[model samples]
Structure formats: C-alpha cells, structure tokens
Target: MNTIDKRKLSRPNFNDPIPNMKSPSPLPDATIQQKAKTDAVDVLNARTMAILWKE
Candidate 1:
C-alpha cells in the first residue's frame, strides 16, 4: 500500500486574471426572454411535426 502527502499539491489562485481574455456582452432581458420563448415554441413545433409524420 502507498500513502500520498496532501501538502505536496498546489492550489490555484482564483484572484489572478488571465491576460488577453475578452468577456462577452450579455443580451438585454427582453431579448433573452424572447429568445427563450422562441426556442420553446420551435421545440414544440418540431415535436408536433414528428408525431404527425409518424402517423
């Protein structure tokens, strides 16, 4: 049986920022809601079409 030492592991620093990384701008709340609704409607339509085609 082998034993490992926990003190030998190196921890990551979350406070440090990476260079040359760009964050994306988020969409407005209205746009986000509209997109989600559109996606749900699309999924429903696809499911309905699949059932109709199988009949």
Candidate 2:
C-alpha cells in the first residue's frame, strides 16, 4: 500500500486580502410547494371518487 503526504493536499488561500462586493438579489417567491401539495391532494381525491363510483 502507498502512503500519501498530507502536506501535498491543495486548499484555498484565504489569507490574501479581497474586495467586498454586493450580494445577488433574493429569488422570487413562487408558491410551487403549496400548489404541488394541493394538486396532489386534488388528484388523490379525484382518483378516490373514480374508484368509488366504478361498478
């Protein structure tokens, strides 16, 4: 088995000084999760009704 040197690992140099910049704008609020949950429940209800009405 070959052994590796721990010092040979590469890492980011954060010791250097860097300029501060403005962060990106927040994402838009899309009520997708709520809509999906409601849609799932609607589909489930619809399937249940179909099964119950079937002869």
Superpose all Cα atoms of candidate 2 onto the true structure and report the RMSD in Å to 1 decimal: 9.6
lDDT of 2 by residue, 1-55 (tens): 1234444345445775654532243533345556778999999999999999995
Candidate 2, lDDT over the whole model: 0.64
What are the per-residue Cα lDDT tens digits for candidate 1 across 1-55? 1233443345555577865343344777678779999999999999999999999
Show model 2 residue runs off by greater than 4 Å.
Answer: 1-30
Write down the lDDT of every candidate, Cα atoms only. 0.73, 0.64
TM-score of 2: 0.44
- How many angstroms is residue 6 displaced in model 1 relative to the true structure, after the best TM-score fit? 30
Superposed Cα deviation of residue 14, candidate 1 (Å): 26
Worst 10 residues of 2 by lDDT: 21-30
Give residue 40's error in model 1 in angstroms.
Answer: 0.2
